[model samples]
Target: YMHRPAFVALLVVLIIGGTSVGTSAKKAYNYRMRERDVGKSDIVWNNDEYVLLKNGDINKAYKKIEDELGIKALKISVVPLEMKYDRLEIREGIATIKFLFNGQLLCFIQAKNDIASSNNVVSDRKVNSEIYNIWLDKQITIERNKLSDDQIEYSMYLSINGAYYYLYGIMEEKEFEDIVSELRF
Candidate 1:
């Protein structure tokens, strides 16, 4: 059921997409600390395909990421007791991974140094104090809106280990706070 033109177009699109993905192919990073600080570290902030991390242990994955990226990678140190958190991964960015919880894709976690405007890739809407609170006495910028009667979208920013992290996706507010509280430097 494919016309000649349609088949050719599909082939062209596949080739283009495959080519782009190839450019960002997975690479292994190693740490060799010198006099360089976090700000001056040479981290490849490039997009990469998902990699299954250290048996899905976040703490183990965090340690591996820190060692590999040659930076102080952030950790969701304690992944809310007994929650199904077997899906964790890391790319070559500000400590990023595709996080899953309770058999659902929770959000994309990204951490980078400094609170630069470039990092505000999330929405500009900010949630009020009633819906958000300062965790660990650290200021958190939040934006949330109900996507439907049962689903709420959340974009939250917080500082940890001298780097800024933002979580963006649809998840329960209570679940979000538990993860925030577990963030350790």
Candidate 2:
């Protein structure tokens, strides 16, 4: 009975304090790692575009995209317009680019193939024609479709090249056009 209540209170305080300190240290370490990762990329925060790709070579960038997306023979180029993006991630045949402004989602870009055939409809006639054109080395098809309200989808089907690329996101019509205008190849 030597100050039993006091000893119990002290023990509780020590446990709580240790837990908080550990949590804080972990958070700080994660923040440092994120900063380091961002530094390794070819992005300068003060620049016009948030993601300024190194060397500005679309073909090289496309290879990176292909590896990330697990796709084969992806031959295309894109030059993004001036815009701020929060982060970009590519994993499991998908590339996601997220744009944020003041901690709010402005828009995003998702690039992937129609692997599940859920969004696209393909017929025998279309396949036969595509094959013929590919044999002739004229199998490049670029199409743009406007989805329901503030959403647009741009597709570039490279039959001969054996890859299909799509860009779709929720953004202003004018802004979307600006981005589409920058696409090359």
Candidate 3:
């Protein structure tokens, strides 16, 4: 009869663990919904897969990065106005993030939040942003590689706020120039 109590205890433990996992998952879902709603923009989240956005409201994505890094994150000023996406995903790395706008691959941004981990590559091309960002390295440099007929990949090295940021993306020439030139705080 004493063995029966041990079996009951085991069952209780399993039940409790399952309930705890369910509760935490629910909490995460609720929190994501709240944050999405608070944006008050046209960002639509059907599930955890991808966030479909017509207006391209990226507040949640950039805000999350900033909150985690404790530093301001970069935002794209010039965006494709005709974009209509249906899925959303945030692929994360050690200190990197690649986000899809609802369904399409937008860009890849890696924030080297560590000062010592900054990229040491010498500036290949002079980068001048009339707009000054405090977090930007004064001697920021950039390089470009043509990936395909239509896709041009650009990598911009930024040393800022005692950290470094590597911005990488493949876009049209005009789009890339507009993004790099129009970057703001």
* CA lDDT for candidate 1: 0.55
Question: What is the lDDT, from 0 to 100, of the residue 41 in candidate 2?
Answer: 63
Mind giving the per-residue lDDT tens digits that candidate 3 earns over 1-185?
89999999999999999999999888656624313455565343343423334334455556666666666766655555443322223343224545443243544353545544534555344442333334343433456765557454666766557545566555554555566655555
lDDT of 3 at 177: 57
Model 1 off-target regions past 4 Å? 1-56, 86-89, 114-118, 128-137, 159-162
**RMSD to the hidden true structure, all candidates:** 17.2, 16.5, 17.9
After superposing candidate 2 on the true structure, give the runs of residues whose Cα lies further than 4 Å from its correct spot: 1-63, 70-82, 101-160
Give the per-residue lDDT of model 2 (tens digit) for 1-185: 87999999999999999999999877654521112135456332322332344324433445566566555523222333433445556755555455543333433233554556443534221111111122234443434455566344443333324344444344454444444444443
Superposition error at 90 for model 2 (Å): 2.7
Q: For every model shown, what is its TM-score relative to the native structure?
A: 0.51, 0.34, 0.48
Model 2: number of backbone collisions:
1
Higher-ranked by lDDT: 1 or 3? 1
User: Which digits, one per residue and each the tens of the lDDT, describe model 1 over residues 1-185?
Assistant: 66998999999999999987775553333323332124744232322222222224555556666776555655564454334444445654555556655555555455555444355464544583333333356656557766646667666776556555666656677767656656554
Evaluate residue 3 in candidate 3 and report its C-alpha lDDT on the 0 to 100 scale.
Answer: 93
What ordering of candidates by lDDT runs from best to worst? 1, 3, 2
Structure candidate 2, residue pairs in collision:
69-93
Candidate 1 residue 69 Cα shift, in angstroms, is 2.7
What candidate 3 gets wrong by more than 4 Å, as runs, is 1-57, 82-106, 115-140, 148-151
